[model samples]
Target: MAVYTVAQVKINDGERYEKYRERFGAVLQQYDGRLVAADDNPVVQEGQWSYEKIVILEFADLDAFNAFADSESYREIAAHRHAGADSLILVAKGR
Candidate 1:
C-alpha cells in the first residue's frame, strides 16, 4: 500500500524557508518522492485553524516513506525547516 505524509507548517523565516524549498526539492528527487501538494495560504472551508503552509507527499509504501524521511538527504534539508518553520507531520496509509 502507498503511504502519504501530510505536513502543516508555519514559516517563521521567509528567506530560510526559501532555501529549504530548493534543498528539499532536490532531496525529494533523490529519494523518488512524489509531491502531491505543496501550498502556502491554504483555504479552510469549514474549520477554525491556522497554518502558513501545507505539503503532502506520497511514497510507494511505508518503507519507502521511512527510507526518505530517515535518510541523510532529508536530514540535511530538515535543518533548514527547523530553523525556518514550526511544523506538524503525520503519515497515513493511502486508500
Candidate 2:
C-alpha cells in the first residue's frame, strides 16, 4: 500500500528549519519517497489553524516511508527541525 505523510508546522527558528530544508531533497533522493505539497500560507476552510506551514509527502509503501523516516541521515537533519519548529505529523495509508 502507498503511504502519505502530512505535517502541520509552526516555526520558531527559521535558520535551523532552513538547514533541514536544504538537506532534505538530497536525503529524500536516497529513498522511495517524494515531496507532494508544501504550503507556507494556506487558506483555512473552517476552524482555527495556528500552523505556519503544511507539508505532504508520498511514499511507495510503509516500509519505504520508514526507510526514509527512520534513517540515520534523516534523524540527523530532523534534529534541526525539532529545534526550529513544532510539528504534528500524521501517516495515512492510501488505497
Top lDDT: which candidate number?
2
lDDT of 2 by residue, 1-95 (tens): 99999999999999999999999998988995889999999889999988989999999999999999999999999999999999999999999
Question: What local lDDT score does residue 60 receive in model 2, on the 0 to 100 scale?
Answer: 95
Which residue ranges in model 1 land beyond 4 Å of their true spot? none
| Candidate 2 collision pairs | none
Off by over 4 Å in 2: none
Clash number for every model?
0, 0
Candidate 1, residues 8-93, lDDT tens digits: the string is: 99999988877888888788887788999988888888977667788999999999988998998888888888899999999999
Cα lDDT of all candidates, in order? 0.88, 0.95
Look at candidate 2 and tell me the lDDT of residue 10. Answer: 99
> All candidates' TM-scores?
0.93, 0.97
